[model samples]
Target: MTAIDILGIDIAKNVFQLHGADRRGRPVFKRRVMRDQLLGVLSGIEPCTIAIEACTGAFCWARKFEELGHRVKIVSPQYVKPFVRGQKNDGNDAEAICTAVRQPHIPLVPKRTKEQQDIQALHRARQRLVNHRTATICQIRGLLLDRGIAFGKSITKARRMVPDILSDMNNELSEMARDAIAELWDLFCNLDRRIISFDKKIEAVFRASPTCQRIAKIKGVGPKTATAIVAAIGDGREFRDGRHLAAWLGLVPRQHSSGDKRVMLSISKRGSQHLRTLLVHGARAVVRTAPNKDDQMNVWVNDLRERRGFNRATVAVANKNARIIRAVLRTGEPYRAAI
Candidate 1:
């Protein structure tokens, strides 16, 4: 009997599809197992490489398989998609994973530690609350507009004007309408409090982690950005270099070049959208203040802004910052300010 060189498991909520392949990539066994039997089946097989697609529970399964004395590779679903043959059933999906894992050049998602997951969860929860707050603000503004009471788009303006408008019984708002708007206002305030609470939690995490504090030393990177980067990439050892880290964050330009001609577009916008947003927002803040200072970094920022315009300059700063952050994490050295 040939040894199973690689086993790909297409995991779902209940059922799981397993595709085992030999050294030559020939299918040795194709089986389906329930959630209860998954570990039992894998435990019986001789230790080999297990390939799984990156998803909600992929990391947990990877850790389990690693404990079972088998190597695990979490391939991105996009990489597995192109390898699927014929129909798109569970067996085929599992086979596609096996095929995708065979290619050594394909980039693999790093297995995140439990601590990293916890930090990521905090960021996610905070972002969700922020989104809810924004929606609440918009609703409050829109309701006021319907009653012929309008204010500036700024959130501060909405917060102040809403209460004033609610108190003044001189406008078009009826009793029922006023009560409804008042409830939304309460919700807005509640969301604000929740978001603030999350902010403090993240700040605590940042303060406690020496690595996060070190990353925060980069001019544009604040406590939030530092924490987010650390949560997403841990110590950054998996990345080859700064450029590799930047590319992974989708800061690198998209290419459409063929043959001798070269065509470059905007940033690829891959990977974690939240991380990319934080980096870009921080860079934008830096770019906005660059004109006021004469520091070495600001000088370059000003020159770039003059040459490429404001938006491009902001992205360039973000890309540069991402690379710098990767170096800081990888080297474990303190970030030095440009004199």
Candidate 2:
């Protein structure tokens, strides 16, 4: 009870490990409590800074702790790993969290509000469905290929060709094989429908959010990218600047350097891959169409594409767009493209 300044909780499904430290980082107490008893235990202690690893239930717990007037710092698991002493147990993990939270330089994970989490959940669900749909398409193609039938890779082509192939008796497809492909085709259609439904929901979310609309004004950013960036980092305040946001999105290049030699590799690819992908895909579209536009952004994109090639140009546009997004969010101003 030596005026605990920071408390770390290694959270799990059932048991919870707690480590309390004073302002000077000295351990005050260590204990283990059940899930149901967690609140009761914390309610007795004076409100202090609580540290937890960013994992499955960390955000929910952070919200709960904040309600109890305790400041919560959620550090990424990788950042906390270096601070762990001895073997990796619940107690040691808790101590590691406590130590990591005390470090002023370590970047903390942004605390997401309930609405942001819901948006992310929607994105995750849609991504999964998309993956399933892709798999189904590939499966359909592979099945047909085995029977010496070949068609274009386009999803539309596959949908039109498959039924014709199944109906024709001149092909090598057996009845059982046709039945299996039919089942998979049905599954693909179902998944496609589900994905469309999710798309509508995302559209609704984008239409409702003014922040999403403002950022979407950027040439490369669509409603999807705008919603995703907002969902990931509310007003972009957590990041120091737009490059910080780009780096968080893994748009920044990785570096390996010593002495006077500096070697930069591909993008670090950190943070959310989903958001990064959306940004890059949107940027690619913009880059592709840059040749037709006379805006400042398009001119830069066209010149970069000619010099660095298409892929590099696309990534460069993504980085630039991320910075623009951060500025828009920070200043509450609309993005204006230069003529």
Candidate 3:
């Protein structure tokens, strides 16, 4: 095994592009390795700094290389984008990642643990099921409305009212439409079961995870929110402060400034959409029962509601909650609601 430095990997499902450079930033080794042979291939080489774009399945390989006595860093794909030369290809991307890694201050991604990935898988499944359920609900609504039947805004309400509406032989509805609703109802039921199963699995995970247990103390955070935040940010110490964490989560307002003028736009809409959604939803839930909430957040939200409308108020509270989450996680401190 020859010594090497700054090895970059462009990962795919089957084929992986590897670019190894010498100590002075000159290209030395270039080859493609099959997916199954990666560990053996890396094991054959001497330890050095490894760089790879942060994408799906990259964390596992990072862990593997770390075990192989190499320093591995995952570069954000967005940060690597500018480094790509005129044309984009696996080799170019690998080289770009290599170049990006040499910078001492490049922001690195937090690697997820196996347990964090498990929680993420649950979230992915639940999101899929929710999408399917919504589609089924929309179909039922459209079909029923075509036959002049009305329903409330929610799928659960549609599921409940459909049976009774179809139970009686109403002349307004045809047999074909009734059968369609029945099929749609069955589909909705299946999706509902899947969502409930996901809830149970996530709830069980929350119960068993000590880290998640501690995070759940934040007023707006629940089992899902806590687990998602834990998985997304890992230890949260990587961030310099809660403000940076909030910016990473894209909850902070976007800024554009000039010599004498400054403009603020909407949030960046980057980072984990699911995490942002969970935080916002949890914040709204807390705001719904604001008087009962015993924290500075409750007071803030209450004051905002009197000034801003409900929608803006919800997002404002969520942004604050994101900051609180980061601070708590970074300090390893439990949430102590401010009076």
lDDT of each: 0.93, 0.92, 0.85
Compared with the true structure, model 1 gives a TM-score of: 0.97
After superposing candidate 2 on the true structure, give the runs of residues whose Cα lies further than 4 Å from its correct spot: none
Which structure is stronger by TM-score: 2 or 3? Answer: 2
Model 3 off-target regions past 4 Å? 1-3, 291-295
Measured over all alpha carbons after superposition, the RMSD of each candidate to the real structure, in angstroms, is 1.2, 1.1, 2.0
- Model 1 pairs whose backbones collide: none
- Candidate 3 C-alpha lDDT tens digits along 1-339: 345789999999999999888878888888898999999999988889899989888989888999999999888999888888879988898888888888877888888888788889899889989998998889888888887888898766886898888786954788987887888888888888889999999999899977787888877789999888887878897788887888888888888989889998888877989998988898888778886765776878888887987777887878888888888777787788777
Give the worst 10-residue stretch by lDDT in candidate 3: 291-300
Q: Rank the candidates by TM-score, best first.
A: 2, 1, 3
lDDT of 2 at 334: 83
Of 1 and 2, the candidate ahead on lDDT is 1
Please provide TM-scores, in order, for all candidate models, with all chains considered together.
0.97, 0.98, 0.93
TM-score, cand. 3? 0.93
**Highest lDDT model number:** 1
